[model samples]
Target: MAAVAVNSPPGHADPPPEGRKRPPGRRRIIPWAVLALWIAVLAAAVPLAGQLEDAQRDESVSYLPDSADSTRVVRLQEALPGGEATELLIVFSRDGGLTDADRRAAAERVAAIAGAHDPAGGAPRGVPSEDGGTELYPLTLTGLDEEEQAAAVEDVRALAAEGLPEGLTAQVGGPGALQYDQEEVFGSVDATLMLATVAVVAILLILTYRSPVLWLLPLLSVGVATVCAQAVVYALVQAFDLTVTTMAASVMTVLIFGAGTDYALLLVARYREELRRHPHPLDAMLRALRGCGPALLASSGTVAAGLICLLAADDNSASGLGPVGAVGILCSLLVMTTLLPALLVMCGRRVFWPLIPAHGSEPRAGRGWFGRMGASVSRRPVAILAGGVVLLGALSLGALALPGQLKSEDSFRDTPESVQAMERLTDAFPERNAQPILVMARDAAVPEVVAAAESTAGVADAEPARSGGGWTEIAVHATDPPESEGEEAAIEALRDRLAAVPGADAAVGGPTAQQMDLGETSRNDRMLVIPLVLGVVLLILIALLRGALAPAILLAAVVASWGAALGLAGLVFGPVLGLEGLDPSVPLLTFVFGVALGVDYGIFLMHRMREEALGGLPTRQAALTALRTTGGVIASAGLVLAATFTVLMTLPVVTLTEIGFVVAVGVLLDTFLVRTYIVTAASWLLGRRVWWPGPLSRRPEPAETSPAPAAGDGR
Candidate 1:
């Protein structure tokens, strides 16, 4: 009928106007500019890679004496600056009463190690300070902050290795104490993560694309961006003294590749499509860029916005990831849109190797299950949505038992110097330990409390006025101690000891306790963050979708997915891994990852639904089509990404382990639960009202004729 009309146009219809035109996107100038910027950025970033680590190192300091009053503390403290001491602490215990003989023999050895520059023998020399007990050695380096100090873990380990000479032993802790082991272990890990990530990315890209150039080119562009980003981050760190944590590089890798590759995929797919339609390679590149660029920009904007929300965390550690993550995503976005396009254009169809191009229709048949799944979902919206809600609710219930504690000892592992020292100290001085009972008196009666603190049950000994300021000073010592928890129990006992004293109160202050506080704060933050973020993200959805009901429905689905992820984490890690509970920060972090990332996939799916609606496809057909198209890609991408996170389980550190397991699980659940199962179903179930209250819902005028017709057309 259409062909007959065209041939009979003179009689069948009014003569067409002579001069109509192609779409506005036909202009090639913007794409060329994008290409140039990508190349330029790559050129600029590669040279600055060498200095990134130094720039990234932590620079915080410690607050402790030049050395522990005990010889053991002196040895550990002396490791840093000439006169400065490491913030070293040790613990001690004894079952039999402390005989003078025991104290003297321990004292003699400690005396040699204390303040000894001998660096070579007897009492393993360095700076040291004994905390509240002859049993514990507490030391801190002067003029250093958390980020700036190197833990004198080795000195403590050596002293421990030499033997306690009898019943004496100690445990080393504090910042320098904790970091010493962590830094050593962390160094080995960096190498492994880097190699593994690169190898995996290379192997996957090669296998998927079946082309060396396709694999090599994207990496090259990312490499440039990464190195430059490193340099820039380093410079920024130098200026801001920001202490980059162990995970910074890993984060950067994910952001750069995830965002970068996504853009490349969209562009490449479009390019391939255009090549089939248009004979000229240059024209195809231009067309592909023009068509996909706006979509890519919008997608990137959503991702960047989600990440930036991390800045809401008050903790420097969590807040820092925001800008750090954002930078990498930004760079990835730039390289893909510009340099990647230009490079691909230059390479042209040659980029697709192994199977040389003949004609351009898709190289492989464009068939997918997503459309079918979506259509099915469209058929039964209520059942799917209700099931999803129930699933999320069940999973979230498991999170109730999750605990918040620092588990500092576990985070670092076998490598840190201080941890090794603690092992030795525990062996050498059973009576001495590194833990401290941090006493804080907000009132002016600080002196009396310090004096009376010795009466505390855990007090093997107490020392006052070693460091810091104001209406208060600190008194610390190792526990008189049981054979059990050492300072941990001692600190508790000491807290009870102070209770008898009027106008005085105290809390255990040490790495473990501080971490506990951080965990609690993080949980509270999550509580605040999730609702705030959900509210904000919903508003964004409403603007984009332009409807009252649809946005609310999507938000409901995302919540369900997030809840399920949390419950699933509790099930696996809590029961299977036998973790005391998921790490304190795990729930909040999991929530953030779930809610933010979940919403992104939801938005993408809904956008497709909107597109289908506008095209006049009936609701059910549109959802089925959307599933076949967008759902497949979402699933594929989600699988690969979630798998990458799963690899975190291989790492030795607990913090990373928790992050890895929860996030990987969350992503997997999200793809199936929300992206495919829920959203698809909703689109079908909602139908025209899916566009309700928006201009899209009303029927269009007859003059439109749905443009030139769709794929399976021409009746």
Candidate 2:
């Protein structure tokens, strides 16, 4: 009896060659099915995205500060925008200060307009401004729903236009106008970003691949990702009644394309290298996956970790972004690894058909100058470190001056209805805060509260409430938007007035206060999320490398990258973007996104370095091997990633624009500097210590070979 080994395939030393060539069973079939499921979801999602309410509060800011009437006012402010009420900015310009006759005429005209509603005739509401010169009327739409608010404002605008008194002009601005302005900014930026994104992506891909056919692969994958991701987001919102801003679509565009292209580049770069290595295309693909798969997984895992970290954000914002972004990127990476591979198999030679070169005699590690550069850099570790530091130092100086002010208008920029209304408001009146400040008191203290509030500093005079008892309502007017810090002076002054009111407490409650709270919340959210994301990434790096020191060092690099990114963004926006200040929200967003995601490169490089080390190469030799083999992939992936994020600069909203630039710059720096120079240098200089306390690393043989390169070449 022949002693045949049980595991060997029918007494052969190895499994079938085709087994080695073709992709395994489960990996090939599942992705298309998943993709189909996504297509179905998207078919259900687009119409839904258009239906939800805007994320910003058209409602009043609620404060538990002082008065009982404050509660009543809070109820009114919140209820008003829901069709229980609306407000119009009434302006009157006279040769002199408003006198009794002018005041009466303005009041009467505003009241008449307020009384004139739809055929239902549930009179529009009216309230005078702090100054007699202008008044704001609060009108409830009687029976309109949230979707009808835009039309309601338009109707009111038309009514106001026709009923102006002699020598007096009236304009409507509030939640209604804000809704319109938001839509304008979103539409303008979105269109601009769309055109710019397409142009930039096309040109960059053309430059990178120099093939139109290759260019379309990423576009298809990304398009599918966008439709599916949006559908999921819509379903989530509808099922859970989730609150998302109109900016979701724009954000989805940036994330899907950016992640998709980056992943696509990784695949193409691998495929090209494989084609150069083998006589057969199928053989080349297997070689590509074995060489490139793990590293791609490492890069994407870190990115997923970064995005998932958004769950650490204080409100639903970070959490919402976490799911949307993480799910989107996962979708992108899935397409990259599986769908793309299958598609490549189907397309075969045509994927890069026009420019296929003859296969070489053998596939060799370290493809020439790129390999040499990696080898040389690992030798002069200190110089590399010095250069990296210097580069980061220069770029980071820009971040210190970053403006922290977040524009309130950012959330509403997507809807047509919202934009038209905002435009009407801004054109008609540029300075409206839209959300009104209210002084509320308990039901029992309503009368005294109204009297006291009427006497407050910012209060010009007040209206006697026709409605709630103990809820004698009084309206106060702002000298400017209550949310403006410029208005802080008047608010403080008003606080003093409220300070003197007997048996009543008054605290500022409106958009300005909400803005203040939001700023504080964002800052606090940063303090929390950075650590959480960093920790998760650090643990992941540790698990990937099974090393102690690699995680710590990579995490340190990420922190440095974050600081450097913020420092750079500060320079661009604090001055160049002419922002009032760094959207206080920018730093937190950057830290969780740009910094955390940038960790991916470090993870990818380090994962390969560890693999090479385990394969018995010395620290320097492993570093050289990792760099030579992985550098091109890292650079290619980084280019697509950076390019994708960079497209945000073309968006109209300052937030997206600033974010795009900073994050793009960070990815570029990470690929070129951090992965290539710093990681390699550190690994070389530290020698065995870079992977310290886990296992002692060895220094393997470094061959100085001649410079005749292999087949396919595209940097």
Candidate 3:
């Protein structure tokens, strides 16, 4: 019989003869069909994605825990007369102490602001600071939404700047002004974050593939995923009233680009390998997807599951992130798995260019770097394990130095005018509260609430501000500085005092109260959400590996990585970065991202190891093979993921910068140290027991012989 030619790569198994062939016309049609379908989807998603910025809710009510008193007060404020009041403090300061000219200029500006934007309760009045160096005009601008409030604040600022006396500085500050500044920052976040993320991803992809053409495919696919995820989130916000914060939206972009690119890298790597085995690109893609599909699905699934556990959190911002982040991951997975493959197939093998994986070609045969590392690890698995543990433990010690909750004044990387104004107020008025505490009580009990607030310890003064809608608003000034321990204690004392008012049902809220609530709720959320995330990720790992031991090991490694990452962040943020303290949300956010992504690399390595083991290699041999075959891909993916997050460091928001730095560091740690050395060493040490309780764990070690040829060898 005449020999049948088999166009297989030198090192890999021959392509299955049956079902390898497809009609050429169908192959052409399918890719075009997928491309056309995605184009349509992208078209429909554009408008909705644009609406995502509009749907963002960054108000305190959006992020505060529902159980918090501040949250209740915020809700009640909306029901007050003319809706929630916008308070602005127009601060005018001079270092040499304000002269008559400065005071007159400040008063004139205040009067002009009142004339332009009709103050709600009364005309603006200047309150001189004790040292006479600063003057503040407390104005209430009511009956305006966010846009109008921002415009009003801007007008006030403009008036203050016009005809200002020499050596005098003026700025608008208060909760209203701070909110406006934050809105301004968030308004530009989408464009800025997207640009930075895309630039980073494009650069990383170019380096990883070393092919200009290959990088564009993954980038385009991720862009589509981002748009799709945003559209879905927009619909959820509109239909289900999902709370989408600016932070959440920004984070979703990062997740989609980072995680989606990760999936693309894995898929492309597998496809490139298969290209050397199959004659047709379509056959190669099919075989590649078939080989890597489950691992990809499980990787995204684990991420989604772990994120969804955030739903159990009390903080609305944290809870909202759960669905938003998961949606992004799922969208990325869908596009990468379906659309990316079609595009790669359509482009054909030439897309790989100089390093194209031609059929019948073999990978270089030698013990690669990962192979040598694995060999070294296998020889002294216990020492490597102990060393890894010690290193991680040492890094974790930095957590003890982490600063306390981040204050609002410290939230921005670059000081905004509002924050500077607050600082000026703090410095000039040490005895008076610049930002007053707001107390809401039933109108009938207003007198009682006021008296109690006045008599409360730590309260400098209490006065009725407004009365309507069966509710009365009282402004209480604290004797302590804003967000200080004394102020926090005073707030608690005020709440306790008000709680004792018979039939009053009072609530305390303001910047101070909000900060206190955020700190407490964050602590509570960490307590509740951490276990839930761990459990969810653990369950997914067990299901994917179909055993308890490997999943447990993976979980332990990731948790250790998270602790070390946070500890390192603690050490760096305050001393090196000049941050005042770590944001309360950083720990929880980093834990979720680090653990989920760390486990992602774990899944990649272990799944490959399991595949080798099932192919009848002993645990040590399987570990070495998995490391040699998968190490480069994991490293590339980790670098890409870490680089995408590093883009956040460019943002001015301290929270995002902190999150970006911590997660990036964590990913690099997991990629280089934990996944490469520790996990591989553990696998070698545990041997078949790593897959304990599974049938494969009991399978006898393959008979000893000359080691299997290195990964690229065409044995």
Candidate 4:
């Protein structure tokens, strides 16, 4: 049966006078038209979405800064004969000491690997540590793509393990093995993140609605949004040469679901309210859209703008994430605003059956939890605001204890064979670098470059590995272990010496050099991108809220929350989670996401508050009323967003783990503490000044009266 506007104000009832009635034919056609359009879009989107995995580029050069010397060397090497080689080191060792039998067995295994794979040097030569307990055989595999290289590493590993003497073990490592292991983890990350994020969002939605069926609409819509976003990103990668790494893709998934669901919740809440005041579900949805549409647009715009600021970053992954995240948010906004409304109108009241909203029923009575909290803040805004500030300040101190830059070998939560092998090699060969520093120079200057490299302070040996494309590749070994301070210093000295060689045109690169470049570039990216993001977010807030003071307050709160969340992660990651250091990109990513996403809840509350104030409610009461009305939905949105990000912690990669932890913590803090307590309390204290320079600030407060609580007062 069609819903009738029962208990509606005069002239609002269904079957209005003939002249006032809207054209029923057109009203009926629009929803179906929208639904059909979406159906067609998804049909094309789903197939293209599956191709996103192929477009993802996770190679070292893909993530590196193009301006870095290390990146230059890698690019130059790619033009050489056979392209860049996949370097691997096989280590064979016995704890007490290596017996003659162990040596013979290791040599045989190396010979077998050479015969099967045809290593670059024709055959590997064993370098025994003076300790007489460890032997290292370095192998270089050239002329292989990433997939072929990974397969070759696996084959070499299997071959190296065969027929080993009892009490003797062989481990295949080096940059190639590490790359293979890392890629293997990344290969599974997409599926894991998708499944886990879906599960978390589903549970949160069900809990929020307390209805089995109501949650499915938003969840399905968000999924559709994700597929559409992936298709768009895939197309951009093909056409624009965009870089999409597994990291960027994973973050995009979380962002679409989290922010998309937030938009859905706000719209749904308003729709449910309008249901009591409008006869038809379509009319009610139209009213709801008008009420919440601007806020949704502004909030999503803030997030997208903040993310887009990352384009200023020097880091490729960070820069790539800018567009990827923006696309996800924009796609999410388009779907939630268009498709969700259509679905809700079609399902009507039945979707929320357990607590179906009748045409004129009031929401539950009694001052809700948020109302009570708001009242308390209204009574003592100064004290509450101070307490919140103090809490955040104390938490932020933990940042001082945060660990240094993360090393490549320490980037994983679980110790892989490659990490283990690198560790063993470090301990066994403390005086020799297992990995060589690659130097590229003009072929005519090769002799001078080799002499300069060998003469560098910490140099052990330097040899010309190959020559091609008018360049000669020289492999230089240092006297210190890989990634050690001494080794880093040696690489620096080698670069300095090579630069002094006239007409050499040399560049230094290797695993260690790559790590160094990564750290420096991350720091630079942070400095450049943070300000851009903050400025973008501020402008968006000012545009939405129409108030400088309120936007500034919200921006400050989020920045503080970012600091507190980072500090909290620092405290938790080291002592509680056993992590050594954070990923270089984590800090910048967390800040961008935290500030942009954290402001979403603030917009929901403040927008409502602005509406209430504009409607002539007393400023103090408006603050409380907005909180009373929007508190539950905002909380639910926050929980869903935080939970979706928390799913990243389950992955083995430390970078994702740190990002997930920090963002989840920051969202929760923004929800319960910052938005609920601080912003509200600050608004109450600031009163009209919160809207300074806006007409709302200049408007006089309405006269107060002991009127009965309004319908949405939650009392």
Query: In candidate 4, where is summed lDDT lowest over 10 consecutive residues?
Result: 1-10
lDDT of each: 0.56, 0.59, 0.86, 0.87
Across residues 179-277, which tens digit of lDDT does each residue of candidate 4 receive? 999898899999989999999898888877888799999999999999999999999998999999999999999999999998888888878877876
For lDDT, candidate 1 versus 2, the one ahead is: 2
- For candidate 2, the lDDT comes to 0.59
- Colliding pairs, model 3: none
- Rank the models by TM-score, top first: 3, 4, 2, 1
Please, what is the TM-score per model?
Answer: 0.77, 0.78, 0.97, 0.96
Best-to-worst order by lDDT is 4, 3, 2, 1
Greater-lDDT candidate between 1 and 3: 3
Over 4 Å off in model 3, which ranges? 1-11, 17-20, 712-715
**Alpha-carbon lDDT of model 4:** 0.87
Q: Write the per-residue lDDT of candidate 2 for residues 1-715, one digit (tens) a residue.
A: 0110012121112223664544556445554565565567557756654443343222322112112233334555444323234443444434334566665665665556566654223443433434444444455444454456557666666666564556665555554455445454654655566566666677777776766687776777666666566666667766775545434456556777776777677667656655654655556555566655765676667777877777666544445666667667776777666556656655666677555434543233325555766756756778878888777777778765665566454442233333333333333333443345545444555566556656655554444333343333334555454455655554556656666666654444444554554566676777888788778877877777777787787777766776777777777664565565555556767776676678777766776677666655566666666666666656766787777788776655666776777788777777777777777777778777887666553343445334334222333
Candidate 1 structure quality by residue, lDDT tens digits, 186-271: 55666676566566666656754667678787667666666666766666677876555656655666556554654555556556
Instruction: Give candidate 3's whole-model lDDT.
Output: 0.86
The candidate maximizing lDDT is 4
Better of 1 and 3 by TM-score: 3
**In model 2, which runs have C-alpha deviations exceeding 4 angstroms?**
1-84, 92-144, 159-171, 187-195, 276-287, 357-380, 394-397, 407-435, 451-474, 478-481, 489-508, 696-715
